[model samples]
Target: MAEFYHSVTLIEEKCVGCTNCIKRCPTEAIRIRGGKAVIASERCIDCGECIRICPHHAKRARHTHLSRLSDFTYKIALPAPALYGQFNNLDDIDYVLNGLKQMGFDDVFEVSRAAELVSEATRKLMVSGKIKRPVISSACPAVVRLIRVRFPDLCDHVLPLKSPMETAAAMAKQEAAERTGLPPEQIGCFFLTPCPAKVTDIKMPLGIEKSQVDGAIAISEVFPELSQKMDHLETVETIANSGVIGVSWATSGGESAALLNEKYLAADGIENVIRVLEEIEDERIGELEFIELNACAGGCVGGVLCVENPYVAKARIQRLRKYLPVSQNHLMGGPIPELMGWEAGLEFSNALTLSADLKQAMQMMVDIDSMEEELPGLDCGACGAPTCRAFAEDVIRGGCEKTDCIFIYRKQMQKVADTISKLDGLKQFSKEEKKD
Candidate 1:
């Protein structure tokens, strides 16, 4: 069965045998062979890191193009809060919203509106005292997948709210249809996404039965048009509907600010987030109810699929926050969206959904363990596999042969040399051939 999204793939022609991606992948999903890169699907988390780092732009995120929106009678744009950080001097919210319209989206919805709902939901979850301490954010799909694969034990601590993208997609679809008298199918809710993981999330939702999002357009794909559109539009910043609290959801610590909880902590970037999650899993940060983790540094603003410099984007985001109107007290008002029953019970499936059978995985694991013990431990990527264990899995999967392992190949060469020497002693033809 094909996976819903293969986050990382190879562009054979662009590869220069640099081996950069093989070393950077968190899951060790990439390999270099025949002077090109290859992706191992089962190990990929779809973080989009490789896409950002590839100078040749060989790595591409799988996203729906804006033209796909033509299929629907009504099109609504649901821009992730991180999308706001893509442009410099984008202090005016209206200009940003209008930019989406100019790009052919009929309507624009703030992901912060869903952030408002998420904020309310998170506050209630913290106050209800029903969850285990240090509730993890489900906003970042990469972070969620990391928990599933590496920190499976910490699955219980994750907050169950559907991601802000899901929240806004649902709200936009339901409201657009109700107000416009269109069927749900006629209304397209397109997410302006930061990474490929969100694309995969929309295709295969974790901890939820289904996602409300119709499709997604990559931010990088639409950024050029948005930039051109912004040149003519007047600045229009709308803060009354969803204020600063919701808008803050874009960057690191933005969730904590929305919650107005000083006790909780927010962390961003994959490696940093993983380290913090590991500590949390070990009970290092005890008695905390909220943990916001974003896979990209500086939050979604720093996503791999983004166009602008992340640091400059983060600064622009800080300026935009000043105009937002959501206050802690205003957010506390009755009927907060958070009170709307958004939480879901998180239960991880032990069965590897990516694999066809347990027997194959077990056999692969055994082979991996054996090969790993014999490896040089340098993780050099010279053998065309990201790691020795990965090479073993490739051998088991038939993508590679045992000789792909440098150590195994060396051993075979030694045996060949010994056999040639032994044959030299018994050779009657060797001397005759040399004379000839």
Candidate 2:
């Protein structure tokens, strides 16, 4: 089994165990045990859904702080395109890019530039028809992990291309090393991430042995300082190179739209993406050449780490898009052919299977079904499981017990009382007969 480390974690003291996270979790990966939320490492997709739903602010994304920049001789910031939408009424994208440089970064690399390269590579892959039908986008790490845990069969449909963040990190490091004559180890590439899933991806990337990104900084953490710097700027640098096609990748349908002349479907939000994946698994949408699924609503703009409201951020991205030139006129660059080398190593992590032995797993399934029949059938999270059936499964798997169900425990206590009453009645009747 592969080791798992998640970027989305719980701050135990703050959690009230209110079932907010467990109920909303797309995967029933959360359980309220000992009055604190416990996340099953294997089941978690690092989607940050819990982080969004928790009222106590207990759930948080683990990320590297700006202070870590001092460790490296040269620090480069790889800002996600979604970062541009964080500011209110921001006119030029360069302001955000320049702000990053002012915040101690030696250079700022736009992930959108890498997105353009990914778009081209994806277009070529789709045109070639070398892979399976309805190829899924690999841009969203959360969605990729969702498929790994819940929709393992659909793993083959996931595109093997490296995410824009990874590509940008790789390029940034190499370019920085070359320009500065600094050792690659001394030049650190830090991703400005809008989501915890990206942080997890940087730490443990799929389809590759390791990530090129040295660290990740949450967008929400940088938003306030960056905004102040942008406000104080006298003149913003004209260094924004990515065009509309690349920049638009910040929102939903943007990726599909960029892949011109293709029959593509885009789904945003974790629930909607799950529905689309289900349809694909059922072969209902086989004719579609590609499918883009974003875990966050309105795509990256809705990430838990993002500062602005998703709808407002989406509007900002649209307005920003209007100022950019067309893809052909402002082509940033093409795919780095070497980055595709990771494709060959791509394989399903198979995080979903319950047991390795077929016979044992079959028996466990039978036990789960039997146990579920005895449950209250409420699908309530009171028993620390999302559904009654899931609770039964957990019981059979030894993670929980049938007594954990309040109804079941009450019924057992009632039975005990009835048995005691019967014994008392029988003893009193026998004593009366003896006296007669």
Candidate 3:
């Protein structure tokens, strides 16, 4: 089995074996077993859909706390554009940045500033015609990981660029080291993340051997301290640099719009993202030159770790963008920088494969098919697995028994009762004949 590490986990005590999570999961990475939810780490993208759907608040993202900043000699905060949306009636991004600095960060870096640079690089890459089209954005770690596992055909189409968060961390560390005369190791660049996917990305990166980010802290977790600081601030620092194009990335259609290309498609929400990928894989969406997909409904603003409602946050982001310039960062005229691109190429993961051995896999497929035929074809998720087909696979893999399905159990019980009735009738007829 391939090793799997994830930031999303189940609180077994709080889990009521509710089928809500399993059904909402795009990768079917969750299952209810032993009356608790279990995550298949290899399949999980840490999209936090389960975290969003769980009524009992059983699923949650494990992220670095503010205390972790004490470990570093010089701490830097790389706040996502989504963080700006969390503030109420916030007109300036500098307040959010200064608030983070007041809340213990030695310095603050805007991920949106890095996002603008990424956007410029993407436009240049698109012009070079060196990659496949409609090129998909690799900005969302959840979407990138989703493509790696579920949409292998679209692997080559993924833009070979590190996410803006990673880029911001790299830039923050470099600047901090130069200004403070500190070693790179001493400068901890932490992302104020809007999602668990970035937390997992920092822990187990996709296209890189290692992550540039030192830690991932949830925006929701930082909201209280930051809000308190913002409320008490006498003067807001002139910290905001990036503009409309960069900050717009907080909501849906932001990145694609930044490309300044009309022949592009953008989709938000996990289900819609899946549908778009399916169509692209089938070569149906041919007109567009670029594609941007966010796993959350309203982009990063919709992330589970965000405090404000997604729509409200999205509107705040729009209002926040109105006063900003078109864009603040731009790439120098030349080839793209190596540091900006992914160190490695995207590859398909065999985590979803039935078996390693071809013959064993073939036989397992046959067994799964046979078992599926016996199943009630319900994707109801009542059998602990996500779907009847998944339940069948569990039966074939010896993970569970056929009777685990309520429908199958009921059918067996009914058969046993019918057999007893027939036997009793036979006994009564024999007794009657003897008496005659």
Candidate 4:
């Protein structure tokens, strides 16, 4: 098995082997082994569920530091719209944008602007009726990975458009290179991400060959500095690019609402998204034109990296939206003409593929079914697997033994004791016959 890069990593020393993460993980990607939580890299979607649920704070998001900004000649900050919700009594977004410049970014570009473009593009795509019903949002990398791993059948329904972060990075890099008369390599575009999944997306992007963004910095890592700067700053640059529709992308139903179409559905939280995907798989949601899914509850505001309570953040975002001008005009008149088509380069990750050989895989499935029947069906994590079915799969994959399950071990021990008792009785009967 090849090792893949993961944004969410465990600090083993801090782990208490608590089952909080195991239960919260939407994909069941975590297991307790040797008194530590172990993340199955292939199974993980970097949704940050473990990071949020862990009491010990053992899970951390791996992201670029502010010091990395010094490496590039020009630095562009691509701040997510969710950043606005992190602060209290923040009336102006300009303060936050300007604060990025004080923190070493040469220029700041709002990802919300790119979101406007994506919104327009999606609406146009929806209008064309070229895509499958209930076209899934590609903005949430975690959701996309979940589909790839658990719902491969619905992979085609995932909208092929690039995420706002990616689009903004690409656009910023191009614009920076042109304006500065410097090569693209000299211009670094760093995304101010609200979640670990976005960091992973930058490191290992889907749909695109290479990420335009040079790196990702967690919003939590920069919040303190930004807040301080905002508190004392006398003058701030204007953030005029993004409108209400774009900035609203930070919360649940934002994208769908931006489309101005009633047929779209927006689902937030990975569990809810999973339920919606299952419905799509069952052909129950064919009437919908689009579906926006975010891995975090309350959308990006509920991201593990975010500091504010999701409900509070969502309220702030709604308040901010009320102040911004609303226009019927589509921003950027849809995505750039070059990026309008489906992403033919993208393919399903297929992380859940049992085996390469169909016949062998079928046999393994049969074996798993047989093994499951013998299990207690408690779905306990004592054996380090989330469910009895999962335990059976683990046994089939040689990751565990039937004896590892306490119930199975007890049954085997009882059988051995019965055999020994029967042998003793036979020996006693034979001895009695000899005496007679």
- Candidate lDDT (C-alpha), each: 0.78, 0.87, 0.92, 0.86
- TM-scores of all predicted structures: 0.86, 0.96, 0.96, 0.95
Off by over 4 Å in 4: 1-3, 327-336, 339-345, 429-436
Q: Where does candidate 1 stray beyond 4 Å?
A: 33-35, 234-240, 327-344, 347-370, 392-400, 422-436
CA lDDT of 198 in candidate 1? 89
RMSD of 2: 2.0
RMSD of each: 4.1, 2.0, 1.8, 2.1
Superposition TM-score, candidate 2 onto the true structure: 0.96
Candidate structures ordered by lDDT, highest first: 3, 2, 4, 1
Candidate 2 lDDT tens digits, 1-436? 2588899999999999888899888988899888789999978989999998999999989999989999999999999989988877877888999998899999998998888888888887787787788889999999998988888788888888898889889888888888999999999999999999999988788888889899999998898999888889887787787888888889999988988956899999999999999998898996798899999999999998899999999999999888887563222355438775355534555455667899988999998899999988998788888789879988998988788898899999999999999999999999999999
lDDT of 4 by residue, 1-436 (tens): 2357899999999998876788788887888888888999989999998888888999999999989998899999999989998877666778889888888888999998888888888888878877777888888999999988898888888888888888888888888888999999899999988999998888787887678889899898999998887777778778557778888999989888988899889999988998999999999997788899999999999898888899999999988877677633354543446653335644666566778899999999999999999999988778877788888998998987889888999999999999999999999999999999
What stretches of model 2 exceed 4 Å from their correct place? 328-336, 341-346
Compared with the true structure, what per-residue lDDT tens digits does model 3 show for residues 32-95?
Answer: 8988999988899999999989999999899999899999999999999999899878888888
Better of 2 and 3 by TM-score: 2
Q: In candidate 2, what residue range of length 10 has the lowest lDDT sum?
A: 327-336
Count the clashes in each prediction: 7, 0, 0, 0
Which model is ahead, 1 or 3, in terms of lDDT? 3
Report the poorest 10 consecutive residues by lDDT, candidate 3: 1-10
lDDT per residue, candidate 1, 1-436, as tens digits?
3764664566677888787788778777778877888776656778888887888878877888888998999999998877788777766677878878877887888888878778777787788877778888888888888787777788878887777788788888888888999999899999998888988888777877677788888888888888888787665444325667777888888888778787888888888997898899888998676889998988888887787777788888889888766543234455445423445666554433335577877777787778677777776677887676666666766778888777778999999999998898769578888889
Clashing pairs for predicted structure model 4, backbone only: none
TM-score top scorer: 2
